[model samples]
Target: MSEKVISDYNGYDYKKEFWENVDREYEDQADRMAIRRLLPKRMEKFADIGGGYGRLANEYLKRARKVYIFDYSKTELAQAKEIYGDKIETKAGDIYKLPFKDNELDGLMMIRVTHHLKDMPKAIAELYRVLKPGGVAVIEVANKRTLPKMVRYVTFRSKVNPFSKEVANYKEISADGFYNYHPKYVEEIFNKTGFKRERVLSVSNFRSKTLKKVFKTNNLVKMEEAAQTALAPIRFAPSIYYKLRKPEK
Candidate 1:
């Protein structure tokens, strides 16, 4: 078989370069709020797939008996190990070929990682295989059908179709394989992989630079919390979070 495309962050300091800033505090809090609502109250084995430097590990650490940060970067994993030490386990592996055995995880989450995946179906199947029956998985996607993009399409300002249920790639925006996917397409893949849709939350609804400049981060986060569930049906947000479960036989 041919080798699968992987978005390797081996030498990158994702936590420092991407997250350590005042500008994205609202987005970070918005994500955490959604995750808190979706994640199981308690679990035996929980993992954060593509959890670089364990940025969100503390969210699940108290809830799960065993928490792991699994990623494709040794550098990130090493950082995770340094920060978390024995509190959380770190593993380096591909999303399509996870190291965990079948039915080993009580719950798992893959946030901000879907866009990097070239074979989403294969990666999702691996998640289904590892999660126990009735286990929950929280997956996040960069949405192609955002309101701004739709407006651009309708106004003849952009060539891409926002209504189409296909993956949208703009290499010019980010050459590192950044993709935006339609929500329906992602849901269909999850359903095909035997996952039942539990809930959907529209995160980062107010991710405008102008809005951030005008309002405080906490106020924006409060607005985001209120809008996540209400705006989910329309799915006009740039980031969409899905709560899925594997049914018990």
Candidate 2:
């Protein structure tokens, strides 16, 4: 049986929303670059877990012989199929109980999706289950320890504990959302799941209303690249990218 978990995505019609907005383009690009950089060099096949609308999976075509869009969202999965045609394959299942056979994937990525998961360990174990011994996986974390949040806490204007190992609850303009994790917590889970951490990058560093208004998207992307290259050791961005590998048997 699939493990029971809490999530904010059960009935969300993502195709009718989110990506449709012109304003959210830069945010999309921010995550796109993170996944692109950490993608495996040689991939025979890979599954883009929780890949809605196939936005991130589309980018994997350059590396993978086949890219699979695996998600439980009917609307978004249909949209992905219509948009990409036969270029990508679609699979329907819960991430807790992946549909693929054991050792089926050479690479995998779960981007912009982990925040909604309430059971991170079980999900990570499932990811490890289907991946070949030598396969690579890239996952994203919605870092609660962002620089802005910490600065706000120091200035006495915020209630969020950026350093808390516990999941942080948040509210949004549309709905009350799920929780975000500290990067260290996610790192510990990956380590416990038998994955070797390959790399970590602090991306979406320029994710602020003021900064976005003052700069163009192209310029923001350039600066994001520079931050990722120079500040490789620190993870103070709102989004943290992790590259992991299953140990070679």
Candidate 3:
């Protein structure tokens, strides 16, 4: 049976009707970049840990022969089933104790999942376990080193006065709010876990919510391209992304 852990999103439904109906193209550019780093090889068997609502799985299904999703959120799994049909097979499971056999998957995609983990080592070990010899995996983090993120965290933890500091910009405790991560820490963990590091990709470059708002127009492709370049230099910096492969046994 799947473990009953606390909802990482603090009850926010990532698959709720409003979230699915809202114009996500404006905000999903970062997501697309994260997914692309995984680069699902055609006709391979893939597993998506923390595959919330199958958003990233939707992209994987287009390339892979078989795709399995493991998610703790039943609400997201329900939405995934409704939207993806049989293209995705979902298991209501936690990342800590994956249900699959060892060395079975060809690739793994952990999109937007790492920051929410209660235990990062256990989760990465499970990921390494299911992936077969020579299998690749993509991991994404919130990049705590980013200037924008630093300011936000500092302000949130400020003690002197609430009026003087900026108000907490992020209102909801989505999946990442519970357990936070930095890229260097992730790299060290992965290395200690025996997964060989490959490449890194950065998503949002600037910390300006104002700039994001200004660019959140109908022209999503243009906006993403601009953001991609802006964020390219720090793609390997903290709050970045990376590809890893399980060493061949």
Q: Model 3 segments beyond 4 Å from truth?
A: 1-12, 21-24, 152-177, 206-208, 217-239
**Model 2 alpha-carbon miss at residue 199, Å:** 1.1
Candidate 2 per-residue lDDT over residues 1-249, each given as its tens digit: 244553544467675577775466677887888877899767998899999888776579778888899988876788889999998999988888999998999999998887777688889999999999999999988888888889988898888888889877676622445667898898999999999999888888888888889999889988888787566577788888889999999
Alpha-carbon RMSD to native, per candidate: 1.5, 2.4, 5.6
Each prediction's whole-model lDDT (CA): 0.91, 0.83, 0.67
Quantify how close model 2 is to the true structure by its C-alpha RMSD in Å. Answer: 2.4
Q: What's the TM-score of every candidate structure? A: 0.96, 0.91, 0.78
lDDT of 2 at 157: 84
Better structure of 2 and 3 per lDDT: 2
Over 4 Å off, model 2: 1-3, 6-16, 171-177
Candidate 2's C-alpha lDDT? Answer: 0.83
Question: What digit string (tens of lDDT, one per residue) describes model 3 on residues 43-101?
Answer: 47888788878776656787788888878887777778888888888888777889889
Q: Which 10 residues in a row give candidate 2 its minimum summed lDDT?
A: 1-10
Lowest lDDT 10-mer window, candidate 1? 1-10
Best by TM-score: 1
Preferred candidate (TM-score higher): 1 or 2: 1
